[model samples]
Target: MGRRIGIKDVAAAAGVSATTVSHILNEVEGKRVNPETRQRVLETARELGYAPNGLARGLRLKRSNTIGFVSDQIATTPHAGRIILGAQEEAAKHDLLLLMLNTGGDPELERKEIDLLLQRQVDGVLYASMYHRVVEMPEQLRSVPTVLLDARSNDPGVPSVVPDEVLGGRTAVRELLSHGHRRIGFINNVDDIPATHGRLEGYLRALAEAGLAEDPRLVVTETADAAGGYRAALRLLQAAERPTALFCFADRMAMGVYRAAAELGMSIPADLSVIGFDNQELICDGLYPGLTTVALPHYEMGARAVVQLLALTGAQDQGTGPAAQEMLPCPLVARASVVSPPRL
Candidate 1:
């Protein structure tokens, strides 16, 4: 077996005392060392391929420069690549390593993962939910510096970074209204969910802002999935006050809306206009007329969450401030799905 290279070997090659080498390695300067000497020592260490044992350094500082990333089944999800890329960029900037653990969409497994991360002595934890929903965080995470990405929780102390769903929702509705859509309908998921409720609030707020009375019949609250949206659209179009423009909570649901419209002999933007959210790629490509949507900046959000977590970890270690909620605004992307209301 090859002998392990230690600080002593680098010190000997650099002509420096063991203590001086220790100081330089720890970045603790008791005495000012000449720049030339410092450079030589660093070079010798590099040439020797000598790396300080990370475990020893962590023990000395009582901290590990590693952060835990607890996420849903990102490995299997399409948007996973972008989000992971963002997180990696931010983590690299902070000189921190990420230990990612996926929960595979199981809350029980998520709980176990959190425990495992805590056991690993990670400095902080970043909890990322695949979708915008209310997450029940584990009790063990309360003591650790924790951040939630793309999810909301009742705990005020657990800071969250989420896409501004309300803003995105309003943007979707405003665009449709600008194109002369007054009889606008909504395809939303169950109102109990946080993101769903936020979108619903934005939808109602937009209607009220436009001086249009709320038409209960035009709003269909269902699963907001493709199939749910399909069924809801069928009933909505059959009604006496059939809406000419529809805003759905998700792009998947909007795909269902497209199916319902086709069955009713309606051509997009000609007899009906549709807009949705999330901007999922498949939905956009699958539709006959590409769906216009509110893009959530999913990748940016994931990266921002990592940056915020790093910041919080530093601040907490320094006793700087308490954690708080932050949000990123989503933007609208226009496509061929929507059109001006039928000629007055």
Candidate 2:
């Protein structure tokens, strides 16, 4: 490979000193350089296809201007792509670059990835999980400015930004209750996952407020994917006392619920009303008869997380404590998938 062009090359091409080039490229705050100088340096850099050695520059300035983003899963899921888009947009606004790492949901791999980012000297780190669950990050990361998105960590050192899953769950139940459906069923992969558990808590809370005791049989806990929801819906419909309405934890599971209802020759809303979370656009628009869902604001969450992370890192640079945690609210988007319960 050819040797990479450096600032020196640009300075020579622009007929200016290296210091001038540096000041123009870094764009020092509160230090105004001549606009003509800035334009000349930029033109020279472009003409020479000059790329700064970010790692070397970071070492000299004691700042990487790069943030590490580690996610539990992204390669296989379309969800991760959206989060990335949001993060990239925010990073651009702050003139920062992102170094992405995927752990494939392995804790050990996550630990290694964190170490690698630290070695590269990132300004901060953001850990995101595809599913809402408790994560055990590397102990070495205690010194790093870290934030989490879409999941919570027991380690207080790391602040988090997660979807208000509990509120989303509450919204689902309330919508059904408002439609006069008391006998509502819940479908979740597990009651153990933080996101699932929080949502379930909201569901129970809503039921209690309505003066309804939870029927154990109406709550279906299985795997979190489409297959899990499919089987759970089958059991719910086959029960001697079937629920008039169902709230699925994910859009994927809602797909399963739709299938089961169809196989049983049940018409939506008229015979069985359904609700789901995650408000994924494709699932919401592509459902056989459409699906009512709770909008997650996932892209917005991702963007905000990166922006907050930069603020925290800036604080630390000024010899201050880490920034406080940020929590964003979830909003519900209504679509056609629910109706009033059948009259006795």
Candidate 3:
């Protein structure tokens, strides 16, 4: 309604040049300005309600101070929402605003969303997925400072922040082995996905380390859901040498194992020890006995993606080297589902 306070008003009131005020407010590195002048300029700006015009500033600096976050169903999913929260928090720490967009796993929608963000002149982009997999990055992303979250590009040139699935798998099996489980079976996801391969590799590695033979009969590949888990569990439980413990690829599948165990009149940890991955709280905590599982590190992946994207954007501005890929660790969450095997 009234007159808008400008940077010049703050400079005049603070008894300083516009250049000095710009340096102090924008925080241009290595520019030596007196502390007293800096404090005075900030106080004057606060008192005058001076807000910089984002568009004008962006045009001048060729940086929007805004990061674009594009995800395929991660933003809308309940369990994966933490990834967005983490990215937003980190962006705020650097005084950057985030523009979030969801594509619902549709390639056409993905391209449209990316084009829209580019048209808006976002400083950089963060591409994320609901699950860990290899994604083909759109050509538009190649020209911008882009980082992948919870996914990797087939091209090694793109930077990504993803969970260490192999380590998570090893940790799950190691927890079972520590409880004296020699006959442990694995209910795995289908072989095509990246997580399935990495997790299965860890499973086999842990078995080899423990001097146990790899048993084809003890492993079953499923669809990574409740129905698939139920069918796979039935097959394992009906075997002549039924496994005493089971490691599921995901918590959703673990729910199916619980159902099968119930049908067989088997008690959790008393008759069958179980462990799962992706520690979805709704499934894990609501189970009769809380399910012990490996966390997917969704929050960490999102936070690290922002950190990497900012770093890459800064590096590009400074003519530095290329961005590097990062993988965050998944921690084990102990609960009531796992216990020592019953003595035969």
Question: What lDDT tens digits, residue by residue, belong to model 3 across residues 1-344?
Answer: 59999878899999999999999998899999999999999999999999878888888888788889998886546656788888888999998888888989988998899999998788889898888889988898888889999999878888999888889889999999999999999999985988999889889888988999999999999998999999999999989999999999999999999999999989998999999999899999999799999999988888889889888877876899586778788899999999998888
Where model 1 places Cα greater than 4 Å from the true spot, the runs are: 1-52, 105-112, 317-320
Best by lDDT: 3
What TM-scores do the predictions have?
Answer: 0.82, 0.83, 0.85
Write down the lDDT that model 3 would get: 0.90
Instruction: Estimate every model's Cα lDDT from 0 to 1.
Output: 0.84, 0.83, 0.90
Residue 241 displacement (Å), model 1: 3.1
Ranking by lDDT: 3, 1, 2
TM-score winner: 3
- Compose the digit string of candidate 2's lDDT tens values, residues 1-344: 59788888888888889988988887767767788988999988988888767677788998888888888778776678778888888988988888999988777777777888999888888788775667766677777877787777776667777777778788899999999998999998675776777889889999998999988998989887788899999999999989999999988899889989999998887999999888887888899678998977678878988877877876776887664556566677778899898775
Error of 3 at 226 (Å): 1.6
The Cα error of candidate 3 at residue 203, in Å, is 0.7
Give every collision pair in model 1: none
Q: What tens-digit string does per-residue lDDT give for candidate 1 at 232-292?
A: 8999989987899999988989988888888989889799999989888888877879999
**lDDT assessment of candidate 2:** 0.83
